[model samples]
Target: MAPKITVIGTGYLGATHAAAMAELGFEVLGLDVVPEKIEMLAAGRVPMYEPGLEELLARHVAGLPGSTGRLRFTMDFAEVAEFGDVHFVCVNTPQKHNEYACDMSYVDAAFDSLAPLLTRPALVVGKSTVPVGSADRLARRLAELAPAGGDVELAWNPEFLREGFAVQDTLHPDRIVVGVREAGGSAEKLLREVYATPVAEGSPLVVTDFPTAELVKTAANSFLATKISFINAMAEVCEAAGGDVVKLAEAIGHDERIGAKFLRAGIGFGGGCLPKDIRAFMARAGELGADQALTFLREVDSINMRRRGHMVELAREAVGGSFLGKRVAVLGATFKPDSDDVRDSPALNVAGQVHLQGGQVTVYDPKGMDNARQVFPTLAYAASAAAAVAGADVVLHLTEWREFRELDPAELAGTVSVPLILDGRNALDAERWRAAGWTYRAMGRPRA
Candidate 1:
């Protein structure tokens, strides 16, 4: 018989994981403390916008018409402990307020709530991104708290899901890694069976010790953050020298060794993962007394943060020195396109900065308006791009949504008070905007 799966915590990671598990032919029960989120998911509605996630959820969530009915959700931990043989703890590990360390309070709470109710042999798999050596401590805690102390074992399996591409990433992962305390333990056997579908579909399964598994997530995020900052650093150099960073990136990306995935030079990276992961990694290294080895990550972080401020400066320059009383329209608010997540979003940061500088900033995003309003409530918001740019002195294209790319520069030019526009993401077509009687300016590109 196949092991029943339970996902603890139904936020972005947990909701996607639970839906994906159901798609893979497992009976999945997802638990969350938030009543509204649980109510939403139970009705086959995703709380936030992720491409294709709601449609995917609709196909599998229990009550929807023509659904598989394999997935169910609840707020009760007792029901979760009774129903699942394999529990995946997919709680968020956000950065602690005013500190570089990762906040493990959610992970701790999930374990505390579920451990004592484990009256049978089960595998508790941790899929949350955590500091290294956390699995060992959590394993000890589980043994101490659970009634079936020896029967309940722990496994560390950190997730690598990107916000926008979460569904595809989960269903067809590049690789599946599990960290086990004992070599060839029952935890390994059970996880193998749980992931047999993906394994059969050519995803490599790497079995390793706990520390390496945890490090894989942070190290990978740190490297990706470095790659983004490295290119943005080149953009800064390109701007000073009047050179095009796009051409530079394109030429360098031709080398097979340096593939062109995260090389897009823009307003830098921000969302739920990259920024916090690198900082937490640095903090963890400091705790383990290996801080110097990863000290360059500080510079990587610095470069990324500098890009956001640089965009703000560019906006001010476009509006003639100061933003005092200028009607500035921001074209996007989310960190990136295709998702509604605005946590640590660079676009919103720029919008907020411009707003603070007395620019009458009206922000618009296809899906991020609600979340953006919550984060930066005082900033002006608009229902559409045309509405945002109406009578605007200058416009800033901060997020590179496909809809923004599809927008007609001619139509937009007619709405703005001034025809000046700044492409923060470097994603817009400069020639088209320029031809439409708008001054198109972008970082690291020659002025037209």
Candidate 2:
């Protein structure tokens, strides 16, 4: 018989995990403290926009795709403790207010609420990204809290699903890392069973000590952050040397040793993960008294931030120095395409900068307008890209959404007051826009 699984927390990670587990033929119950979240999930509507998450959830929750049983959602911890053989704590640990340290309160609360209910034998797995020493602390706490005490094992299984690709990444991960307290544990076996499809596809399964597993997530994010900053730093130098960073990245990316992924140079990196993870990693290093080793991340952070200011200055220049009374259209507001998540979004930051500089900036995004409104309500939002460009002096394409990429430069040139477009993301076709009777400017490109 398949082991019954309970997933605690129903945010992006937990919601997707619950749906995936049910799809894997396990009877799953998803739990959360928020009543509204549980209610929404039970009604078969995912609160956030993740591609294919809703379809998968509904298929399994309604017992459609050969499901052994339907998945359910509840706010009852006692029911979860009694029903599930294995529990997944998928809480979030966000960055604390005005500090580099992480706010672990959510993780602690999830464990505190559920650990005491594990009277019978069960395995409690952690999927939340946390500080290095967190797993050990939680393991000891779980042991003390449960009536079964040491019988209930604790394991750390960090998730690496990027937003917008969460469903596919979860269903078909590149590799699976399980941090167990000892060699040959049930945690690895259960996780293997949970990921049977990906395992069958030959995904590598690595088992390590608890601390190592905890550090794996932070280390991965920090390295990705470093990679993005590395290219942006090159972009700065390329700007000064009259060389194009895009061509340089393309040339260097051919070598398999440095295969291109996050090499695109633009306003720089931001999202729910990369920016805060590096800071939390730095804070953890400082707490461990090894701050000197990760000090270079500070430079990475600085370089990434400087790119934002540089783009603002570019916008200012495009609008003829002072932005007072200048009409500018800011295209795209989400940090990335196909995602509504805007936590520390670079596109919105650039839009806000133009607004602050007294430019009459009109912003438009395919899916991020609602979120952008919550973050920067002062900026003018347009109904569409055409509307945003209507009578504007210049257009700043900050986010590279597919719609923005496919925009007809001829149509946009006819709509705008001035035929000037600055490609902040380096994604636009300069030749196409120029041929359409508009002046196209892009970062890291030689000035026309």
Question: TM-score of the candidate numbered 2?
Answer: 0.97
TM-score per candidate:
0.98, 0.97
The best candidate in terms of TM-score: 1
- Residue pairs clashing, model 2: none
Candidate 1 residues lying further than 4 Å off, grouped into runs, are none
- Mind giving the per-residue lDDT tens digits that candidate 2 earns over 1-448? 7789999999999999999888777899999989889878877888888889988888877534553456988889999999998999998889999999889999999989998998898989999989999989999999889988887898898999988889888888888899998868777787777777788998888899999999999999988888888988888888899988999989999889988888888888888888888999999999999999999999999988888899889878887898899899999888888788888998899888888888998999998889899999999999999999999998999988889989999888888999999888888888899999988877777777
Question: How accurate locally, in lDDT, is each candidate?
Answer: 0.94, 0.88
- Candidate 1 lDDT over residue span 1-448, tens digit each: 8899999999999999999999999999999999999999999998999998999999999888999999999999999999999999999999999999999999999999999999999999999999999999999999999999999999999898988999999999999999999879899999999999999999999999999999999999999999999999999999899999888999999999998788879899999999999999999999999999999999999999999899989989888899998999999999989999899999999999999999999999999999999999999999999999999999999999999999999998888899999998889988899999999998888786
Which candidate number maximizes lDDT? 1
Q: CA RMSD for every model?
A: 1.0, 1.5
Q: Which consecutive 10 residues in model 2 have the weakest lDDT in total? A: 61-70
